[model samples]
Target: MSDEARVVRIVPNGPVMVQGPVRIEMPDGTVVESDRFMCAICTCRRSKIYPLCDTSHRRRQRAKDDESSTTVTVQAPAEA
Candidate 1:
């Protein structure tokens, strides 16, 4: 991202849509590039496509649909 870097919005229970010259780093020390200034990334961290929005999480509803649907939410919920 640059000085005028765009902000990536992490929607609750949804994807991380980013707008910018963003760089995506993989767990295997590989890096991916964003084509445009706007892109939707998986927030579930279960994307087979890694750094790209494959919609697999939405299709499978794996980590989502549960109580902890968000990975970037600020506050923790009260225990049940």
Candidate 2:
């Protein structure tokens, strides 16, 4: 493999897979580095650890439904 080459793969409704070691520059000029061979960058913003994927992109389950409806359902779009 070339020294300058890295592979980035995008998962279906998930994070962007990036080959590391990667240095991420935050908006405030903070630098975050990862020495792992591969890293997952979060796209969903729900992660407590921002800029890193913690599998927070998955769909949420509603805890309760209205009294009028006994069953509640959710439909997510198919991956493109």
Candidate 3:
């Protein structure tokens, strides 16, 4: 380990950023490494690339609000 400090930042509703180069050991006994200046680790588990952020956690646009509007009707049971 180097004397330099490693910084980790947790982004709200997003991935966790880490200062690389880093070596990560997966649950399957496999090790993954990255030598990039920074690394984005997925927290939402929605990334197509596990342990990496592909911006898959971003909110997607749903059908137009007006077109996708839903109306619910509740009916009372008949009196005994």
Candidate 2's TM-score: 0.65
Q: Estimate the TM-score of every prediction.
A: 0.54, 0.65, 0.68
Could you give candidate 3's per-residue lDDT for residues 1-80 as a string of tens digits? 68987899999999899987667777665566666687778899987566776677888733455322222122343346
lDDT of 1 by residue, 1-80 (tens): 25875677987776888874456665555666665566668777766555666566665544444423223212233346
| Alpha-carbon deviation at 42 in model 3, angstroms | 0.5
What do the candidate models score in CA lDDT, each in turn?
0.60, 0.65, 0.68
- Residue 17 in candidate 2 has what lDDT? 91
Give the range of the ten consecutive residues with the poorest summed lDDT in model 1: 67-76
Candidate 2's displacement at residue 9, Å, is 0.6
The alpha-carbon RMSD values of the candidates against the true structure, listed in the order shown, are 12.9, 15.7, 18.4
Ranking by TM-score: 3, 2, 1
Task: Single out the weakest 10-residue window by summed lDDT for candidate 2.
Answer: 66-75
The clash tally of candidate 1 reads 1
Task: Report the number of the highest-TM-score candidate.
Answer: 3
